[model samples]
Target: MSVTDKDRDILTRTLWGEARGEGLAGQIAVGWTIRNRVDDGKANSWWGESYAGVCQRPYQFSCWNKSDPNYAYLSGAKPIPPREFAQAQIAADQVMAGMVQDPTRGATHYYATSMPKPPVWVKGAKETLRLGHHIFFSDVP
Candidate 1:
């Protein structure tokens, strides 16, 4: 369960891609969601085994999806604005180092409120937190 340099970098990029516009609080929320997934203790987890894996897993975080506008910056094809990336890195490091409280409250999933419709999996699930433009859920199957 050790965090590596690559994990830190990927997690930083993920926060950048997924929540950069939402500011540091939003990025921290996203980071904790990924940390919850990484620490879920499920063997052969579909969510992936590490921070990098969870972030890079296809279709989980939209920024990694090829069609997302942030993909270019997240994938290094384009440079992230310096200040945004620096904030993302701080969020990633703090979350991974257990230096911050998890505002998501053990949430492993979330969706931006901007979605036209809520994703089906959130149906009947426990809503853990709402921050910025996202809604977070736990107890989702």
Candidate 2:
């Protein structure tokens, strides 16, 4: 699917909200996870139809959630720090353009290791990779 400018902006903001502190690799990993969701076919259409759709899909990535702590910054109500935003943009650009490898393998799911407990869905899923604070997974069935 073709990506529009709005899609790129939303994707970059999402990377900024979700993984900006984890640096470039972390941002790229998050981007790949969203792309994986987009490519996941009809089985996961609720994850959305494009980069923007996936990133903005309700309750999937919490940063876009209304109650999420990062909402203000991610939504532009509060500005992201310039350098961090730039780094996230770079990560988003590379991933969206298919210029980088899928560092999380084929992971379509992840949760920050910082979570008090792994989500129930993680059970029996194939563990993919750990990048920064998040643990990636796939093949949950």
Best by TM-score: 1
* Residue-level error in angstroms, candidate 2, position 58: 0.8
Candidate 1 error regions (>4 Å):
none
Angstrom error of the Cα, residue 19, model 1: value is 0.5
Model 2: which residue pairs collide?
A: none
| Candidate 2: tens digits of C-alpha lDDT, residues 23-65 | 9999999999999998887864878989999999887899999
- Root-mean-square deviation of Cα positions for candidate 2 versus the true structure, in angstroms: 1.3
TM-score of 1: 0.97
Model 2 — which ten-residue stretch has the worst lDDT? 38-47
Instruction: Give one digit per residue, the lDDT tens place, for model 1 in 1-141.
Output: 988889999999999988887888899999999999999999989999999999998889988899899989888999998888899999999999989999999999999999999999988889999998999999997
What do the candidate models score in CA lDDT, each in turn? 0.92, 0.91
TM-score of model 2 vs. true structure = 0.95
